[model samples]
Target chain A: MSASGKIVIALDGMGGDNAPAMVVAGADIARQRYPDATFLLFGDEARLRPMVDKTRWLKTACEIVAAADVVTNDDKPSAALRKRRSSSMGMAIDAVAEGKADCVVSAGNTGALLATATVGLRMLPGVRRPALCSFLPTVRGETAMLDLGANMQCDANNLVEFAVMGSVFAKSVLGIDAPTVGLLNVGAEEGKGNETLRDAAAMLRVEDSPVAFHGFVEGNDIGAGVVDVVVTDGFTGNVALKTIEGTAKLYTGFVRQAFKTSTLAKVGYVLASSAWKKLGQRADPRRYNGGVFLGLNGVCVKSHGGTDALGFANALGVAVDLVKYHFSDKVVEELNRLRQALGEVPAAAAGGVAGAG
Target chain B: MSASGKIVIALDGMGGDNAPAMVVAGADIARQRYPDATFLLFGDEARLRPMVDKTRWLKTACEIVAAADVVTNDDKPSAALRKRRSSSMGMAIDAVAEGKADCVVSAGNTGALLATATVGLRMLPGVRRPALCSFLPTVRGETAMLDLGANMQCDANNLVEFAVMGSVFAKSVLGIDAPTVGLLNVGAEEGKGNETLRDAAAMLRVEDSPVAFHGFVEGNDIGAGVVDVVVTDGFTGNVALKTIEGTAKLYTGFVRQAFKTSTLAKVGYVLASSAWKKLGQRADPRRYNGGVFLGLNGVCVKSHGGTDALGFANALGVAVDLVKYHFSDKVVEELNRLRQALGEVPAAAAGGVAGAG
Candidate 1:
């Protein structure tokens, strides 16, 4: 925030399928909600200037910073961070790290974005690794799932950290005061999973634990809206998340095919277009575009790489909401509560805010 | 099969939600498909005789065997196998081991049924563990996935065994020649997944491998019909399977809600009733009831415990198909080919067919 009460955002240009144009246009849409917000955009000056010039309020609100390098999808995360500090994604994150902006938004390669942000803005104290949390509309309402591929393999301790992170996310972003958290397992029974899951369950079962633990839940529970926060290792979480998206696609394809079978069916589809339109909104991937990177020192939102401008705008909205919620501080408080419940306090001198310079 | 050309089947009459009535009624329906089949029904004769008498041909087709005990849902699988040998499930599997029946069908406890059948009927020569394979309808056609909750943690070799078993399943049951088998992973790239998956892929990539290896596939690939057979460890496979089921249900619920929003939609729904009926058939879970136990000495099918006679009959149908296809023998052939592809043949003296006495 500035002296005049403006929210400053750092934009990663030259990221995603449609880069500078989508980034600039999305910023324009987002500023309508946060009129006092300004953008410190990073990308090629030549490529970004025209896109910025076309927007009404954007031209006055944006400042474009030129960066020659770019992060490709194939580059390994750690390698990308060590090598591409001058890249657009890196510079955008640097603005946040420097406290030049309150948050950063990028539709870049997910691994690169995660790596760069983790290295530049860094992690909050007492957090081992950051988790990627996203939402999907369930039967009851929207449910949040965490570690959506940030850490492929997580142990018992790592899982507990993720649970705390997810709890804070459910509270801050999803607006749930006391969100129920469930450990993803193969079966609902207590004795169903491996040692790590059992150990994690034991930890979460504590009476004063940070989260309201709902015990173990199976794969079906994710869509059944069984819990507000579904926690698991990144590998399983990623698989389940993608599986849900694929299934939604498959079911939509089936419905479309069913409606195309005959003229009467087609007429019925048109006559009931309003109802189907409501469904279209329900299943729209664009509505859930932002994946919040939890436990970071600053707000960093990862937009879906292939999403359109509207999706990009939604990502900006997410970053703004996260900024309003002070997500990182909430995470630290939750972690403290969790540590207290576990009968110990986090180590001293590491500091509760940023652990690194 | 006997000299009279009848396919002998063993039925666990005291299994599943509906018990003896569902079991007997299902047998009658299955007999209509395979008119040359007879059942050795295992349960109390007092209860089975009345149901057999209700159907015209069931009385002539079924011979009720008095098994005094029954296996309950909560019993641990191995413990149940040891203690309940005279139970209906045990007696039914016993018929197959004794070669008095060609195969068995049980809608009992999945773990108990898998345990009893594996122990009683035994594994084919060179098989370490048996996998449970099931089918789901896809965009291209039906795709088979194995280790659907059988082996929770699979080694590289275990996964390879599953691949060969799944390949055989695709050929014998799904009727695909030289089926393209895919190993499930977090990403499609060769570098993705853990060591077990990478090692399994290396083995499957052998030029003379039994299955046509499609490399790595993501969770979405299962519903996308990207390959003929999808092979994964039981834990991940179970979660993905249930997730798919959950997603379909969620989508169906959303569609129903959409259609109910307006009177015009209700009218259109009635007018396009036939199309919706076809869609209903496509989505019917009973249409895909049976989960086949692969690499077992003889065929065994696990019907969903909650299913009605129709679903039970579908499972019976699956067993008959496996019998006609000579599934176990085909699995042996596939395993032999895989062994050849792997360079060193399996050690001798295990016998070529059934491993147990």
Candidate 2:
């Protein structure tokens, strides 16, 4: 495949439990799947050669960009960003910032990536802080849930910006025109939710929202899919995400144990293997691997570092799609419009002031 | 079941999915299951008679208290409390308030029940607002997650009160001694959570905390059983509860589809029936039906209104247990001690605050 007219994504190869092998395998899969997309793998070249030799696609379609070391899960976010200058994640982000790659993908450390990306790419013109946004598969449909874990704390203005950015991301990537944005609160009533969301709801109600702002949504309503964007402060959003993941795991574990309890059940399991695999595939970690860090100057996709080859492949696909869709530009434009609407004052203004927004 | 030695629990026979039938059946089950318990069924004598006639044990162990009216699920909370003066739920609570029954158990409209109990029984001294607290099963153990769908908005003081009340309830009812009270934040760091939690954390860090106070806990930590009492403002707490419930439903649904996929799986399904049933029983909504409204002067157990006989029975058991364990007096005393330690200033010193409990 020719490099011309192709989007280049810098993939942090030395991240995740599967690490170099999964990254290499995923890169090969992406190269075979999307001939128009090229991957630049950032990791130690010596460790990657074995997998590179095994795949024909990797030889021509993908390229290896050598980095000295890798970031470990044990490292603190600040220390890793500061001390690990030659780490794969740091180099991958640098590649995007230096104009060598259109976007960056990493499964390494979410906090480290957020910190480094914030320092490396810098926030956009009107963006105060970036939010980690992901598409949650809800009963109503798929919707964008913003600040899934990025900022631990946020004022009402921060949430307002999150709504705007989430709206644009959904419109551009999810292809939802005039997406309905909802503030994740305790209830759908305007009188519901915390003080931060209550004040933010007032802003969302009257202001010229970038998206179709649809009042407030409760946690159960998240799956009901009343809106395309669910805006929340990082703390609540993070808890919501983890709770969903944990509950899913626990329920599935119980079912698996149930199925293996009897000999007759073992026979049923054999016959049902294919259908079970299909269902598992539908709920696979790979299918929803990439979550974008919005409100930055450039695109940055963070995949779960604990994923396998399929997950890494999905992350790369997300990076390529994000670059093609120009995700960052859309988010930046929305942020600018929102800032212009709210004036030059800090977005954190109305958090303590209640209805100031 | 002799009346003198048995614990007496009043049940709202007109509440829940099947109304008098489920209530009557549940009361019978509880009576037979625990010989030392008696039930007072409060509902229309005509409607409850046929259901009560179905069981022999209920005839002798349960007494029907005549109530002329019913509180419909769709009625407005305030209107239900005002207009339905002789409703089953109202009568059951009244029995407790008048010291005729040790506890009140109702599978009635949650909002209406909460409002009625608050107005009729009144808040305990130093209890600014009451919270609906329940236990959500997690991987490590059950988490004491509270204010689940209670007050939509809560301030720092309200959170502090919830922590104290939840701790006391857990200790007295759940038999968890010196429960580690944790303020649920986005992160475990002291300064991590939102402003309300941050302020609450500061107050919780004081030497005079009513329970064994841990600094902070995250969403995943809830399932990890790192803390005995997980405290948060109502908005986040409600969202977290619903999110876990929704995820559990989604996962279990997927697993059921997995089992019924093919012919051989049919055999496995039959063999696994026992294990599946056991697992199902563990995750059954009926088993976890009741939620206690803490901070009130009397024991009020609210079960899901749309519940089966098994669920209603669980609710009755919860009420009986709370009464036997003296949940109300213990929690109220803890709240008073906490308030005194914090140097409970008059309402004037506390200034303007919404949901100040």
Candidate 3:
């Protein structure tokens, strides 16, 4: 938090498909919502300054930090890490680590952002692996899921860590005091999945665990909002997330095709357009653009690269909310409490686990 | 094949939620469509005879085989197998294995059916494990996906086998001459996913492979209809399949809620009722009710346990289609060709690989 009780957000202005234009436009939108907040914009001075100047609100609220290099989405994580000192994405993350900014928001290459943030901010004291957490729409409400694509292959311990992190995220962001957590598996039965999920379920089911463990949940349960937090290995999580997105698009396409089939349907579509628009707004992907990288020492959110100004603004809003809620600190405190209750040493004291690629 | 160029299908009369009644009704519907086909109904004669007598078509075309025991949905696969000789589910499968029926359609416990069928019918030559294959509606059309739940953990060889089997299925059932096969993965990039998927892609991309390999496809591709067949390990496949189903239901629920929000929307829904009905029929779960158990010596289709008569009839239709097309023999032929092209010895000569469970 800054002196005026406002949070400072570091923005990677040169990231995402729209680059400085969307970033500046998004900051302008966010500025209206959070009048007290300021931004440290990192990008090429020549391109970013003009964009910032065009937006009166952004010009007043943002300070441009020049960086000569831009990390393209095609850059590998290792390549991005090698250029951390000079890249806009890297410098933005660095500002968060140095405590100059409360959090960092970037519409950049996901792999690059995760790599740069992990190395720049480092993992929290008791956290083994950081998970990429995001909220997905469900029948009940938005549910938070973790390890979306962070650790493709995870052990029982890693899943346990994710469950804890996801629970904290749901609590702090979704405002669920004691978020219910369900391990994603093939079936709801105890003996359904592989050894790793079974073992993780056992650990989560313990009385003193931080999460309100709801045991195993199948894939359908995710969309049904069976629990507040859904935990799984990154491979399965990533696949499931993408599958939902794909299915949504597929059905929407079907609706469009149906409307075009006849003159009566075309007229009916017009008559029903208002209702359909409301449904579309509720299912908008832009509203759920931000994916927070949990378990890091500082707050870091990755926005969708292809998103527009509205989506980027929503991403900024997420950063603001997390900072205001003291999300990172709360997570650390929860992990420490959990460790003590389980009679286990801090991850740092136990020799910190290797970071996942 | 049965006498007079007809196909024989064995029905488990004691299976499904509304057994005997639904089964008899479903058989009557299927009999009307496939007038030349005959059915061998297995269940307690006392319970099945009356139901069979009530349905005019079923009474004329079906022969009832008495089996006193029933495999409850909660019954373990092992327990179901123990009662193989006495259980209706087992006897129906046995009918296929013993050459009395061309295929078996069951609406019983999935685990029990998979277990009993694998034991009763034995594995097809060169197949390491049986895959639970089914069709899912995609934007372009319907696509066949395999290893939905069987073979939870699969190797490269097993995935290749699934691809071959899925291709044969699409050709025989969906009527695609050169059905393109895509490996279901986390990304379209070659290097994405675990070692098994990578290895499977390598094998699938070989010049002489039976199916037309379309390289890698992401979760979204399943719904996009990017290929005729999608192959993946059972765990991911099952998760993806269920996720799609859950999402479809979620969106439909949203649409329903939206239509009820205002008077205008209600009128619009009424006007658009025809289009909505068409979309509903296209997206009907009943139309895609059956999941065929592939890689076994005999053909067996599993229907949804909770499905009504219409749904059960569709499952029976899937069995009849497969039998009429000689689906089992084609799969075996494709696998044998695939093995020879890869310079691998026949599975039968090498002693067929053990079943997954």
Give the true-structure RMSD of model 1: 3.8
Measured by DockQ, the strongest candidate is 1
Best by lDDT: 3
Each candidate: what lDDT? 0.87, 0.78, 0.89
RMSD each, Å:
3.8, 7.1, 4.9
What is the alpha-carbon lDDT of model 1 when measured against the actual structure? 0.87
lDDT of 3 by residue, B122-225 (tens): 99977889999999999989999988999889999999999999998898778899999999877888888889889988877766777799999888888989
Candidate 1's DockQ is 0.73
**Least accurate stretch of 10 residues (summed lDDT) in model 3 chain A?**
A348-357
Order of the predicted models by DockQ, top scorer first:
1, 3, 2
Q: What is the TM-score of each candidate against the true structure?
A: 0.95, 0.83, 0.95
Candidate 1 chain B minimal-lDDT segment of 10 residues: B347-356
Question: For candidate 2, what is the DockQ-based docking class?
Answer: acceptable
Q: Candidate 3 lDDT, tens digit per residue, A142-261?
A: 999988998889999888888888887887788888999999988998999899999988877776666799999988999999999999988889989989999999888887787677
Candidate 1 residue A89 Cα shift, in angstroms, is 0.5
Candidate 1 residue B61 C-alpha distance from true site, Å: 1.5
